[model samples]
Target: MGASCLTDTGHEMGSISLTDTAHEMGASSLTDTGHEMGTSTLTDTGHEMGSSSLTDTGHEMGSFSLTDTGHEMGSSSLTDTGHEVGSISLTDPGHEMGSISLTDTGHEMGSISLTDTGHEMGSITLTDTGHEMGSISLTDTGQEMGSISLTDTGHTMGASSLTDTGHEMGSISLTDTGQEMGSISLTDTGHTMGASSLTDTGHEMGSISLTDTGHEMGSISLTDTGHEMGSSSLTDTGHEMASGSLTDTGHEMGSSSLTDTGHEMSSISLTNTGH
Candidate 1:
């Protein structure tokens, strides 16, 4: 059977196992002579042997018989691994070994990784790796990387990457990297990315990528990312961001960047991203 316990005298009288949620490590027997060596804290040298001939170097030991030498020893690869070691994370400051290393190493590692790669890294790297890394809906990388392309990354990256990366790096990275890494709602603005739902009057009611919607009553609603208030169904609403009823007279738009929808229209309750 597997050794399960350890004694105080520094002996492996039972099995030894370690599992990490951030890194996804599995438990293995540290058997070495069958005496069932007890548990022992990792030392400065980070060298340890077990009865099953298991060897762990530093904190990188993950599999049954693997050796790692870096901050994220068991995270993934060896040497300067990301999050767990080589994994991606919003707050991670190391190299990402995994395929989707979000905000791992580059300045805006998170945004770049999520968008495409090396795109938002430039801007994101400087300020918001955790938040902006995946900011601009992962397209920031292309904008930051190309320096001119502004194609996919530019359109989305420049706007979202710059803002989101600078704010939600830590929180966004954890949640996205964990599972929903591709969600459009980059910032905590509560608006779906690509889709113009952030606005009222059914913005992007048809297409996606912050385009649809035509009303001044729904300021900050991702309304005029392309179409300005001159589009349609809007009165003399201020240029700033605001939220209110889609009727003839709505609240005056403010300098703020959040809109709350009202009634007298097709689905009220609007919230925009800020002019």
Candidate 2:
């Protein structure tokens, strides 16, 4: 059954429902369940669920939900047993499995995994992980494994393996078997980790590594085995690794590492590991 001059689902489900100014001003739509859904704007679109979708100008207060999972502005996926999850304007997917994993804006990065006996698992990815670059990961021992991946521009984890991870920012990989990991700016890794990594502003900055857990910064062109950076230069590897001119700002980790891992960020020769 249809309704007024407005058109479409007008008064079809319920009174004042799906009435798009058929005769009034701001008309609202009702769901199949008989619940009042969203209101229509001037030229914008109304809200819809299931077979009905919301689209148009700004999407204002559009919302969506499926399989008991819901989303306010972005998207949310709840497996087995989970709760409310949200991402930013870019791309950030939050997940859980009998557990909950969340992140803010500046705190965009990494993953959260959990495992016990039999539980649902999932992973989340952020379009923008770092200040303007990178990626992240997280994992647990539960059947449910949640991961958070981010965008990259400054720092990145070529391939990260995180376990029992936490919040990650900038670019860093909390990989390996760790008890509990925290945040970072660039690329990083460890066995028992907890800290942030930093990247460079110019080209490939530098990279860092940690056994007990720490942060790594710079640009790159290689693997983040132990967390490291190589700003605006070629390539290099190692724990606390740093190559290029002002590679490591001034912290030599390996036998032939860079000198300055900070500013004065210049170039470097294969022989001159230092500035």
Highest TM-score: give the candidate number. Answer: 2
Off by over 4 Å in 1: 1-186, 189-226, 229-268, 271-275
| CA deviation > 4 Å runs, candidate 2 | 1-99, 102-127, 130-135, 142-161, 164-202, 205-247, 250-274
**Per-model tally of clashing residue pairs:** 57, 61
For model 2, residues 17-89, the per-residue Cα lDDT tens digits are 2222122112222222212223321111212211112111111112222121211112222111111112111
Displacement of residue 51 (Cα, Å) in model 1 is 30
lDDT of 1: 0.23
Model 1, 22-98: lDDT tens per residue? 22223223222222233222111111211111232212212122222212212221111112122221221222212
- Please, what is the TM-score per model? 0.20, 0.24
Q: Write down the lDDT that model 2 would get.
A: 0.26
Q: What 10-residue stretch in candidate 2 is worst by lDDT? A: 78-87
Cα distance off (Å), candidate 2, residue 29? 19
**What is each predicted model's overall lDDT from 0 to 1?**
0.23, 0.26
Candidate 2 backbone overlaps, count: 61
